[model samples]
Target: MRLQIGPNIDNGRVRLDFRKSPDRPQSTPSYEIEQTKADEFVKKYNSQEKKLFNMTMIFVAAFSMLGWITSIYKRSILWGILGIPGGVIAGLGVGAMISSNKKNNLMDKYNVKEVTKN
Candidate 1:
């Protein structure tokens, strides 16, 4: 028996053919592995949430400190304290809005489709 080896471009799989045909037919199993679209989408969504949360926290702290600087410059500590709640509210609102929109977009894009029977 001679060994023949060549590439088959028709199918992505490498072909392994024998020089002599087998007396009995052979059955091979095939597998279909799915892509990582679902996992990737989830990971991306989580990453976005984490990043946004961290950024929001940092900005809130910075804005509050800015109030202290303003008070020092103007010689009034009470004004600095008054700016705290406003900074926090603005930070929280903006952060929540951004995270919510990103999460919603991801869910809409990667949500599994369902079939209903009437």
Candidate 2:
């Protein structure tokens, strides 16, 4: 991780960066076992991705409920009718974008490439 707080005087004036030093493992892993671990990691990542997406979606739905209430309180029938669906769609769209970004970050951190399905 790297952070550039100010101007790019010397490589963007890095404020903080963390790196792990190389350390050898005590026991050497067999080829078959390493492959199994990689498979498990993918399964975990996929399951976690679905969970995060659902959480974000429910949060947006709650926000839409609040907007709907406000529209009704203001006595704007037409606006309420239009705004409800509009707000829900917008909120969900934003949520999807944020969730996707987070998922990508997780994949990058784990150095795992997502397998595309047809």
Candidate 3:
């Protein structure tokens, strides 16, 4: 394993290359096996995160609707009419975007498979 970090002096931007050499072993008795296991675990974790994010958004929408209903029960028509779907839509849109970006990043960073049987 090699770690290299440098700046492209001409471009004034930092570059990082933490690459395992192409000639490196595709599998090993222990270390490589552990890395593969870790990749699997990260995949599972990202999946669970996506599911939980969906569920939470559903609950938030329900809660917003419940709030609107309570307002209507109290005879506050304007807030009941405007706040419910607005909050729900905004919450879902923002949450979905943020969660999607983070999950993609996690998957990209951890899923490193270097071998395939032909």
Candidate 4:
């Protein structure tokens, strides 16, 4: 059996194709995988979330390091407290990301309809 998955294009739509089985002459139908607004949202949301998360984490780490260094030089712990909020935000972002990612993959979201070959 041959299987092909088309690229996701035009806002998360995919085309699916399958070759007939040999031992049995059963043929799988061809169909287009369409997306709902929810699908579009999920795709866009995941990507944006990743980008924002990374950007936020980078600044957080940088500030945290700066705070640590400043605290050490000044012989005071208060300066290092600046980095604590960044650490907390990073932890919360990680948790939110995990939940947002638990959705069906492309294959699971689609179905097949038989096409008559010319």
TM values, all candidates: 0.49, 0.55, 0.40, 0.34
Q: What does each candidate score in C-alpha RMSD?
A: 19.1, 16.3, 13.9, 13.2
Total clashing residue pairs per candidate? 0, 0, 0, 0
Which residue pairs collide in model 3, if any? none
Clashing residue pairs for model 1: none
lDDT for each residue of candidate 3 in 1-118, tens digit (9 for 90 to 100): 3323323322233332334577656642111112324546444644566575776687668767766777777777787786687667766766777766775565466542322221
Q: For candidate 4, write residues 1-118 as lDDT tens digits.
A: 3345544556466554543455434445444455443345334434555665665566567656665666677775665665456555655565456533532233344343334331
* Model 3 spans with C-alpha error above 4 angstroms: 1-42, 62-75, 111-118
Comparing 1 with 2 on TM-score, the higher-scoring candidate is 2
Worst 10 residues of 1 by lDDT: 27-36
lDDT against the true structure, per candidate, is: 0.52, 0.53, 0.52, 0.50
> How much is 117 displaced in model 4, in angstroms?
47
Query: How many Å off is the CA of 26 in candidate 4?
Result: 44
Which portions of model 4 show Cα errors greater than 4 Å? 1-36, 77-118
* Candidates 1 and 3, the one with greater TM-score: 1
